[model samples]
Target: MGNSKLYKGSLSTIILKLLSEADKMYGYEITQKVKELTKGELQITEGALYPALHKLEAEGVLEVEVARVDNRLRKYYKLTEKGKEETVSKLKELQDYIANMQVLFNPKFGLES
Candidate 1:
């Protein structure tokens, strides 16, 4: 993948959250969405993105639907019930991680050392 550790760690969670919001999205759409959302700050390559999608699909948290669009088959991914639950959990974890980082980096958050 060769992406940053932070992005690699949260990639699946990001995909889950996006799918949870969009109902379904194809691979390229997900990439573009991320770029748009991030104001071009982040760009996800296929090499990194597909593996995460495949892993999530294999985990039974995501389902794929293949449809013919303009005479070509496109695979759209959506969150399953388990995926929905996982999304919530992942978001919570990310939030907690951010909070912990804040506490660690900011001297005066909620505790005194």
Candidate 2:
């Protein structure tokens, strides 16, 4: 992402949100998908992607499958039942956060606080 500070906190949410929509995705696929979805505004690196995946997998929010593709073994990640529930909760949290930021930035929305 161009301004990574703004995206860092939400990286996990972004990944979860994408996996929720896609049945399964590998690390590289997730990176490319984010780039495509954001029209290249966001680019996820191996440095960032794997750690997040590993964390989610460790949490039992994601499960991994290994399969041979061409000559190489690839690992694909899919959300677990817990992950589905987490996705919904995270999405709501992110949406509310964004809306609050928007209203805070645009005074026309009239932030009471």
Q: How much lDDT does each candidate structure score?
A: 0.92, 0.92
TM agreement with the true structure for every prediction? 0.93, 0.93
lDDT of 1 at 50: 98
Clashing pairs in 1: none
Cα lDDT of model 1 by residue, 20-45, tens digit: 89979999999999989888888889
Give per-residue lDDT, candidate 1, residue 44.
Answer: 89
Give per-residue CA lDDT, model 2, range 11-46, as digits (tens).
889999999999999999999999998999999889
lDDT of 2 at 91: 96
Q: Which 10-residue window in model 2 sums to the lowest lDDT?
A: 104-113
